[model samples]
Target: TKTFVEVQQRLDDVNSKLHETVSGAREIKSFVTELDELEKFDQVNDNYMKANIKVHKLMSLLDPAIVLISNLAIAAVLLVSSYLASIYTGEDKVQLVGNIAAYISYLQQIILSLMLLSMIAMFVSRGEVSARRINLVLRTVINITNPENAIKPGIIGEIEFKNVSFSYNNVNENDDKLTLNNLNFKIPKNSIVGIIGSTGSGKTSLVQLIPRLYDVTSGEVLIDGVNVKEIDLEYLRKNISYVTQEAIIFSGTIDSNIRQGKVDATKEEIEKAAKLAVADEFIEKFEAGYKSPVNQGGANLSGGQKQRLALARALVRKPKILILDDSVSAVDAKSEALIKDNLRTLKDMTVLIIAQKITSIKDADYIIVLNNTGGLDGFGTHEELLETSEVYKEIYNSQLGGYHE
Candidate 1:
């Protein structure tokens, strides 16, 4: 059983390595680590092979050894009975021989049952180990759920964070562990808000709260004067569409990918959304156009193209609140500008864009500048932030060479 467990672990490690190399093939090749990756995989595979051989050798010897001992015991019984029979009288010797035959038959049955029990015990031990692992996954709890008396809102696309703070771990006792600290901001209906921050500034954490992905440790998040916790979880998420930095493109046609946002969307609506994201230009170049097949993870398309397609998917939803979480970072300035310009047509949608580049969000109606401590340093137009926020000004100067009028 111990050898069996070792083999199982080694087999899992080998499988993990295989998946990592296959999924990260491009990265491995670009870094010129083909030989290194091959060596790592070979090592893992060899470990699995050795472990498997050890388990098989032990198991194979067990049954044969049991049979050898049982045969030897029967031979000893026969030899002793024969010696006893020689010392007995005629009728007594015959009776003694008959008794020895019956004893031998009973001993054979006992040995056979014991051998069967041993095999069953070995398999049961392996099964028990696997069952414990499966039970752990099944017993895991999901922390987020709809609150009591949840309201299905008739709300406008407004958002507010009132004295909000959050952390992935328990921050109720120690506030110092907060990822976002006392973030206070309100976005009116149909407004555009830009959020800019350095790495680890909790930019993603802030936007995630609006969708109730993680409940705040302290304070509240409100939409249109009503607390988000009171709102129906499903309704709140349905009205919001979030596009992340990494584009997830499934294996299917272009139409199917964008239609994931709205399953019942018309073909024309898909095309319109693609045009808005500037994805239509390259898409039309394909011989199949909307019907063009996409490889898994958008392997067939360039990084910029994948970003544009993902943007189109979000736009097609026409959700009340749209979030672009650095979704256009891979695109060139010309294409990114066009997508931003096209977004202006959605006058009734509240949009939040998280960006690393000032050129991407400087023109936003309200730009949120976050410092290293997850505190808002500025919340105003680009011109206003240039005077109020040193962080914003420094970023603007570095990216654009200087702040423009």
Candidate 2:
């Protein structure tokens, strides 16, 4: 069992290393670190080989030892029974022969049983290890579940944070290490809100709260006058669309990927979404159009193309609230402008754009400036921020370098 566990652990490490090496192959070549990566892979592979050999060696010894013990027991029983039968001929030779035959038969049965156990020992050890690994995941406590009577809400896209605070780890609400500390804001329905912050200022964390991805450590998050925790998880998520910073693409056709947003979406809806995201411009050029196959992780597409496709997926849902977490950062300036203009036309849809560049959200209805200390510095229009927030002004100057918006 111990040797089997070692083999499993080493195999996992080897697989992890292989994935990392393949994913970052370009970086390795550019940095001229091929030898270093190869060395790392070799080390893990060697460990896996050694662990596997140990298991094999143990099995080799165990099988032979079991067989040898069984054979020795059978030999002793036969030799002793035959000798006693021959010597005790004075009393019923026929009865002594019957006893010897019975002893031999019993010994053969025991040997067969031992051999069967030896054959299945490898399977038993493997099953034990696999079961233990699976049980760990099954035993994890689920921290979120639907209430007894979960509300299926009719959403209008208004969002509010009332003294909300959050921490990834277990910590007090008043703890300084909170990711978002005591946030208070109320966004009207159909408004374009821009969230900007220095890196690690909890911009993503704050938006994630709207969908109840993580329940607040303290306070409440309300959507359309209802506490988010009271709403049905699936229903609430259906009304919200979130495009994360890293666009994830699965192995499938472009149409299939987009349909992930709304499984029953019509051809017209799909085309419209593609056009709105400006993805149709490139997709139409493909011979297969929407039927074009996308490689896993979008290896065939450019960074900008992947981001545009992800945007199209989000827009296809036509949700009441759209959250773009620096999603347009990879696209060209013209495409970004078009995307922002299209967003303005989505009636009654609340939009939150988290951007690193001030120009990305210069015309936003409201701009939220999150300070490096993990709290809001200001929340207002662009002009309002320029006048009030030192953080905003610094960021603006650094990016624009005196260029007018």
Candidate 3:
């Protein structure tokens, strides 16, 4: 059983690598623009090939071992029968012959049965492992679940973080290290709030809490004065639209992907969302237009095109709160400006933009500057932050080619 488990693990690893090699072959080919990259690809392929060979060798050895054991059993049976026949004589020998014939048949049946049992044992071992894996997943308990008396919020656009702190590891909550430290801020209804910080400063982590993706370890995340944890999970997420940093496109038509945001969205609504996201410009260029096929992960489209399509999907939702987590990084300056301009037209909806570019959030109604320690450095308009926050001033100067009077 232990040997079977080890072999099964190796087989799974090899299969995973084989799948990656096949699926990412085109990407690897495109990325092999230099000698070093080509060499790396070759090295990875070689390692996978070697591992595959080892597994095959182990499996090949099993057949010979089984055959050899069967041969030895037959030889032993023949030797014993020959000795018994040699010791018998006349009528007793005749009777012994008949008995030996029946015994030989029984011996053959036993050997055949043993071989079948061996095959069954191998399969049963593998099946047991697979069953255990499935059972583990099925038995897993979800940490985040709605309470018994969950409440649905009346209005969800307004968001507040009250002395909230979060740690990825809940086992040791008292540890000084945390992903987000005592964050206290309020975003009013119908406001455009921009969050900017250096990498690993918890920009994405902060916005994720708004949608109740993760519950705060300490303090509370409130939506319209109600603790987010107390609200129904489905109700909270339904009113919020979150566009992640990575533009994840599915294998379907452009229209189908956009319609995922709102299943019952009309044709006009889809087109309007596309236009607002600036996706219609390129989408119209295709002969199929809205019906154009999009490959899995949007591999056929450019980075900017995929980002715009993702933005269109979010826009179609028309949620009360929209969170864009570095969603415009792939877009050019002109297109980014246009998208921001269109976002301003969305009334009665709170928009939160997490961006690396200062220009992306400079004109936002409120700007939040987070330091590297997961704490707020400053919170105000771009102009106010520039005067009050040295961090904001440094970011502004770096991006805008130095400060001006």
Candidate 1 residues lying further than 4 Å off, grouped into runs, are 1-5, 57-61, 76-119, 172-175
Q: Model 3, range 116-158, lDDT digits (tens) per residue?
A: 7766776887688778878889999988899899998686488
Please identify which of the two predictions, 1 or 2, would achieve the higher TM-score against the true structure.
2
Q: What is the alpha-carbon lDDT of model 1 when measured against the actual structure?
A: 0.90
> Best to worst by TM-score, what's the order?
2, 1, 3
- Model 2: how far is 166 from its true place, Å? 0.5
Candidate 2, superposed: residue stretches over 4 Å from native:
90-102, 403-405
- Candidate 3 regions off by >4 Å? 5-92, 130-136, 171-174, 402-405
In model 3, the Cα lDDT at residue 403 comes to 61
Q: How many Å off is the CA of 319 in candidate 2?
A: 0.4
| lDDT of candidate 2 over 96-154, digit per residue (tens) | 77777787788778878877887697889988998999999999988877777999978
Best-to-worst ranking by lDDT: 2, 1, 3
TM-score, every prediction: 0.89, 0.95, 0.87
Cα displacement (angstroms), candidate 1, residue 32, comes to: 2.6
Estimate the TM-score for candidate 2: 0.95
Residue pairs clashing in model 1 are none
Higher-ranked by lDDT: 1 or 2: 2
